[model samples]
Target: MKTTNAYLSKTVNELKPSGIRRFFDLASGMEGVISLGVGEPDFVTPWTVREAAILSLEQGYTSYTANAGLLELRQEIAAYMAREFQVAYQPDSEIIVTVGASQAIDIAFRSILDPGDEVIVVEPCFVSYSPLVSLAGGTPVHVQAETEQEFKISPKKLESAITSKTKAIMICSPNNPTGTMLNKEELQKIAEIAERYDLLVISDEIYAELVYDEVYTSMAAINGMKERTILISGFSKGFAMTGWRLGFVCAPKEITAAMLKVHQYGIMCAPIMAQYAGLEAMRNGQDEVEEMRKSYRRRRNYMVSSLNELGLSCHSPGGAFYVFPSIQTTGLTSDQFAEQLLMEEKVAVVPGSVFGESGEGYIRCSYATSIEQLQEAIKRIRRFLEKQTS
Candidate 1:
């Protein structure tokens, strides 16, 4: 006589909701709350990109695209990859246009992972990673990239985590929540380990263009990595096109073929208008992209300096728009800090523990909002901290 969701797939039922969204939901009904938890860009999509989608709709170009997406969009993605990241992928056989980079990651795991296979999920990563791997019939092995090492996983730690069940390693450069970018040399070391273990590398490069001080390097660009790497990128973070739901996956031809099967069955194709917008974004959106990057860079500087000034030891992130600042000095756990800050100060931020266990002592504050919102959020947080000390 127990109430139950017995009809639900065990995986779906057992999976907890996104930790990022729990707090976002908590703040949704509150008035005057400055929510700095979401990682979305506050900038509007560039005019040219938005206009292209509008023009396409006006012209009645709303029919479904190829299962892999519009060929022209795919070609542009290939060209952009070659030009920006020095990675070459054949548009025809090696690319699948997806609903978002999130979908791309989902399909990539579905295509290659078998039941009981394992993927080493580098921490502290995006919230969706482990759940996606689970849904795809794979086990997610969490591996911490220590804060002392600037949130980068060392080769020794990575190798130690590998097991006979290990089939792949998933890494995000310019990582979400932390904003730590893995450079070319660091990536080369990971590539060598991947080569040694014969494990595939799923590189999420969605934030590749938002980097501030360091150069972004694609895992596939590393020597001998092109074949073993599945690169996922999209227009969401960098191009400010989140609502458009357009992203692409680049992999070896065999892998792409398998992923296309999953994608075609699950999603069929990305939206036609969104594809047009992405086409325009890659072709002529660099200047606007840079403008947004500069804004984020300026905001990042302010947040890092301000957080440090407030005694929340924060590492300077090389890229991306979020800052993970340690709140350990206050003797409060991350969850307590985020919750109390929200309740008292009406400023909403995500507790870092939601990202992964290694994120226990920190909280992630996104600098993607306006400078004004950020400044106000900081002030509110300052008042909250003073109360804690008092």
Candidate 2:
């Protein structure tokens, strides 16, 4: 009899599971673990959004929506994009609501990539980008954004990474793990490169609303970029609607049509209840979103200051709820620092190496939890570092 591994697709078997999951699994069921490992928002989905979903169910709207999602929700998404980012997308033909930003990312790759095509992925980025590109039968060429660069890729680095087989570039603003956001000027430089190279862009802006000191710019808003960019964002990060699993993609009609084929056959539509909740969020949840962003900003400030004070040497992140601090001074690798912290201090944080090689000496600590918890976690971390140095 053949083994299960033998029957697995080579690509699937070769794929490594997310390193974040490993730490989460270990921390689960452990007593008194203060976890900063996951990037999820600690805040509950707003009462209004939840109530909207409940109301939708009470009204007996439980059946499958249109494969492209409800017309109402799509229109709201279009309106929200235009209002927030100044990028125009027509409701009727240019949008597809998805299960989550993850699904949107997957379908975008499926829609545009052919086998052996290359996609330039910026790192340290979210873990899924490379694997998703590979699963789509494409090669993921990573362009490292070093810490000295504030973890933002320069246009020259991006241009140098392109080759004849390059088909797309994946960029996440207000980035994950590092919490670095690309400025409008930086995005314009990238836009120029994309146009010159004739490459598509998959811009992941899930954390756009969480920016603190800097304004978030949509790559689609840049000149000539709207036609060449596939914009992916979701309710998860911005609206704290992770469990609802609602997201959307905005692109040119041709690209949207192609992605719709994959989305239709695979997902049919985003959940009907979630779509209604999303519509409600677009309409009435902006204030709540801003409140959450402000809270994250406060926590981000506290965490960055505390981490640096603890001798961790963290850069001030412009957005998102995470602080990436170099642990090199502790004379430990990122994995070692995280593991030791979990073992000795019961504070779980993600090793930056899990994000990319450029993240080797750092660790990502999320400030999405409460201030009290942040204080306790930092105290424990400081104790652990002192012990290490001694």
Candidate 3:
């Protein structure tokens, strides 16, 4: 009989498991663990959005949508992008409704990358970026964003990662693990580099609706960037529809057509009910989205303050529900701090090193939980820090 490793693709067999899922798994087995590991919003999907999905099923509309997704939903997404992200797409030609933003990324990479092609993956980023690049038969060249730069990759650092084989650059803003968002000016700088280097930019804006202090600029909206950008977003974060798994991607028509083949073969279409829910969300879920944004803002403030007071150097992220805080003061590695804190205090956090080497001295804690849970976690963290010092 063949060995397990021999049976598997060497590419996948050699890859490590996601660090985020490992902590989430550990937390799941324990009692009374306040887990800040997963980045999902705690709010239920808005009643209106949920009702749309329910009513669709009630009306016997459970069939698969067009491979590109529902026309109505795509039109709504097109309009929403124009209004909110300052980008325009011909929904009929330049957009594809995906299973989720994650799938959009996967299809985009598979559409564009040839074997040995390179994608500049900015770090510390979501755990999936580099892996997805590899899975798509491209090499992932990581360029790190350290804490001193507020976790935003500089255009210089980005350009330095480019090579003749570089076909694309992948970015997430407001980023996961660290919630830093790049404003228009900063994005424009990267856009210039992409134009100069003739690189495609895959921008994941899953946390677009969660931004507090800065405006969320779509990468496609930057001058000369629209043609080179694959804009991916989903209803999961903005409309509290994580379970719905509805996402969309916008790109130039030619690129969209190429990605469509990958999407069609890999995922026939997004769920019809979720597409209906996404339609309702894009059209009428603004108020609920704002409400959630406000709540996350409050939690962001509280978590940042508490972590700093407890002697962990924390950055107040502009968007997203997570904070990357330094655990270096306690003289422990990110893994050590996270593991010890979880075992001793029943608080589960992901070590930042899981994101990349630059994340080694930090840990990622999500503020997607309620304030009460955050407060308790803060107390436990304080106690853990005290023990670390003593």
**Would you list the C-alpha lDDT of every candidate in the order shown?**
0.94, 0.92, 0.90
Clashes of each: 0, 0, 0
Report the Cα lDDT for residue 386, model 1: 93
Model 3, 1-390: lDDT tens per residue? 987778899899979999888888888899999988878999999999889989999999989889999998889988898899788899899999998898999999999999999999999989888998999999999999857988988777888889999999998999998999999988998899999988899999999999999777888888889999999899888788888888989999999999999988888999999999889888899999999999999999999998888778888898999999998887888888888999999999999999988889999998899999999999899888888778
**TM-score for each prediction?**
0.99, 0.99, 0.99
Candidate 1 stretches with Cα past 4 Å from truth are 1-4
- Rank list by lDDT: 1, 2, 3
Residue-level lDDT tens digits of model 1 in 1-390: 545786679999999998888889889989999989988999899999999999999999989999999999999999999999998899999998999999999999999999999999999999999999999999999999988988998889999999999999999989998999999999999999999989999999999999999788899999999999999999999999999998999999999999999999999999999999999999999999999999999999999999999988999999989999999899999889888999899999999999999999999999889999999998998998899889
Tell me the TM-score of model 2.
Answer: 0.99
- Report the poorest 10 consecutive residues by lDDT, candidate 3: 146-155
